[model samples]
Target: MGLRTIGGWLQEQHVQLHMGRWLLELDDARAEREFTSYDDVRGLAEGRFALYIGIALTLAYGVVDVLVLDELQLDVSLVRLAVVLLFACAVVVTGRAIWVGRHLQVSSVVLLTVVLLMLGTTLGRAADFPTEYLTTSCTVTLFGAIGLLRLRMHAVLVMAGVYSAVCLSLPGALQGVDALARNVAPTLGLAAIAVVIGFSLEKLRRTDYLRQREVEAEQARSDELLHNVLPAPIARRLRTEPGAIADSAPEVSVLFSDIVGFTPVSEALAPEELVQLLDTMFREFDELCEARGIEKIKTVGDAYMAVAGLPEPDPDHAASLAELALDMQRTLARLSPAWPSPIAMRIGIASGPVVAGVIGRRRFTYDLWGDTVNTASRMESHGRPHRIQVSAATHALLESRYTFSDPQVVDVKGKGPMTTYFLLGSNL
Candidate 1:
């Protein structure tokens, strides 16, 4: 082989000698993807990973002790001490794994490995213990580092490098070439395979975590859309049991408003300008409703609809609607100075029992049914420009808290002469 080829091979061997460096050389993009998933599912996976690894480590130590029991030609007291030390290490590592953070957990594992390595080697030298036993025990420990512990790539790699090196060096140095060849080669091969397996498992874990997050995100978005389309209580009911929604609210207040001169203004302006004007005007009305905690039902061509105390009961629903009416009048008056032409609103409000429910399936709407809704519409249609009209029901509810014009007998459509009053302002 060429010198450059030999040099490249040697460099490859050096990286294999240190698994940490090997992981660093591996695909970084793959590592980042796996880490993102690992971070997302840490709470769930940490306990599972720790439990399995703790069991594996404890079992590994037991097996090693049993295998070397007959071969340990040392003082009984020293052997007992060694056994006590190994068992104690195993117990400490396993217990700490349950509650420690990721970094500390990795540190605990490394500490256990180092303690075992030092204890085994010290005992081996004093007793003339077989190199094969020590090599096997150490190799098993390296296997557990990558295969069982399931730490981050760098942590596992650092561990594998240390144990694998000790297994390779100590056997050949103390025993012979035969021991080195038998122990080191297989340990290296197993360590490499374990690293690959660990990485694959991490990738798989990340993919499953990402999929679960995607499902949760979609569910949240669906809930948000439902809430936006319907009232909170109604939306919740629909989620639990979806069907026709028809319920009579014992009492509620409904308000309807229409632009005073929209037909003429729409004809004068371009479609975009007209739409923009309506959007701006209605947006302000929406803010006023929101501020008063009223629920906006929907807006028709040039009419806006809102309600109070239907989805949930409010004792002062009428007062709240009255405040919203005065605010709407003030909002239009302030904006009219900047408009291309004079703009005004004709508002109507009624308070009474009404049946409210969602209508249609594909393009659904939450609307009210009863004479109360019709009267509110009539209070808008038959009323004068720049005036907020209310039926006797609404007027009675707000008469104590708000000022109103003298009651007038107006000819309401469908319902002949009805006593209504014009809302002037709030007492506050």
Candidate 2:
């Protein structure tokens, strides 16, 4: 996007950026609150390094004084050495002390210090210092220190003012207006350019920070939605390793249930009313299933299906599924909807080995496929309303802990002639 477009967006309601003294700052209170921590991290990262770099460059330049000058000027050499020693002490204090919390403040002081030493060095050799010396000193100071550190607009302007003072004083020290008239333009010109670069860099960093945080917040919301749709463990697996999630659960229990007399009642109510009734009824079932540690498979028309075990195993799968079935009947009985009368449910549970996995590519779901699932459905269809029925396997596991009707031989759909029993209630 163009600069104009980005600037316009910076003023938008979501994250309003305003011009502060010389730099862009958050105008919106909420944006300022959010940006504070991000800006602190940037200061900490940049401040620690900028101090080290300034000290190294200052030390290197002192070596240049000893080698490059025609004669070793003791006063100029001593000045450079003092600046290096001072910078080293600042690094240790800011780098390791508890007051490193004041990184941004330390950084501003470091930049001003560079400008001060450069001025002092020029004044120390007033007669030998040619007008051209300001050009080299100003160039070195701007390029080495300011460019290495990321300073905001106001800080950049402060350095510009300090440099202008040193340049303006040169003409009087040399005792001539010709000195000011000749060299003033170029030195001031560099300071102006530094301001523009500094402002742009600060704006760019803030923009990148805002976008990165947006992406992280969006990812968190999506992961939460995915967890709600699938089991927590299954959702986590799919996120880390995406593919067909399959597992063979040898010991599990499955439950199938349907709203008895649903058709006649649904036909009697308006379409909107019918939908509202279903939503209300199922929401209750969903909450109850969660409380009983049951994983709801899906609801087909008025039929509700769920299972206990597989995704995560429970040795007491049969008992858990059985308790969920009993609660479904009680929950349905208590639900008062726009229907003609009270609702009742027929639930069936079967226990044995089953193959469980997530199905579908875009619109995915977690489900089970095996004889246990089929037997549970058959038990619900063949069993009576307002009652929970179970296969012989499930009944064997629960008869000791739960109350049940006398066993009866019934003709099953896929498998002929199977013995099943009706669940009455819990023993204790």
Local distance difference test values of all predictions, in order: 0.70, 0.74
lDDT of 2 by residue, 1-428 (tens): 32212233344556655686666887666566456555655665666577677677767766655555666677776666666676677667656775554455446645465655454445335335554654556556665555555556666777777666666566343455766556677768877877787777778877786676556555655776887789889999998886788999988999999888888888888899889989988899899878877888899999989888868888999999888888777777677544687667888899999997888888898888999999999999998989899999999999999999999999998799999999999998
Q: Write the per-residue lDDT of candidate 1 for residues 1-428, one digit (tens) a residue.
A: 22222223333332121134444322234434444445534632443464455455545654555455655343533544554565456555545554344454355455646644654555455554566666565665555544444455655556666666665555244356766567767767766765776566555554554455445555666767887788878888877876888889878999999988888888988899888878888899988977888999999998999999978888899988988888888888887766678988899999999999988888787889998999999999999899999999999998988899999999887999999999998887
Regions of candidate 1 where Cα sits further than 4 Å from its true position: 1-49, 52-64, 71-99, 102-150, 169-174
As a TM-score, model 2 comes out at 0.77
> Model 1 clash tally?
0
TM-score computed on alpha carbons, candidate 1:
0.76
Q: Give the Å shift of residue 307 in candidate 1.
A: 0.9
Q: Cα deviation in Å at residue 203, candidate 2?
A: 1.7
Off by over 4 Å in 2: 1-13, 16-22, 71-149, 154-176, 182-188, 221-225, 239-243, 288-294, 315-323, 395-410, 417-428
Question: Model 1, poorest ten-residue lDDT window?
Answer: 1-10
Clashes of each: 0, 0
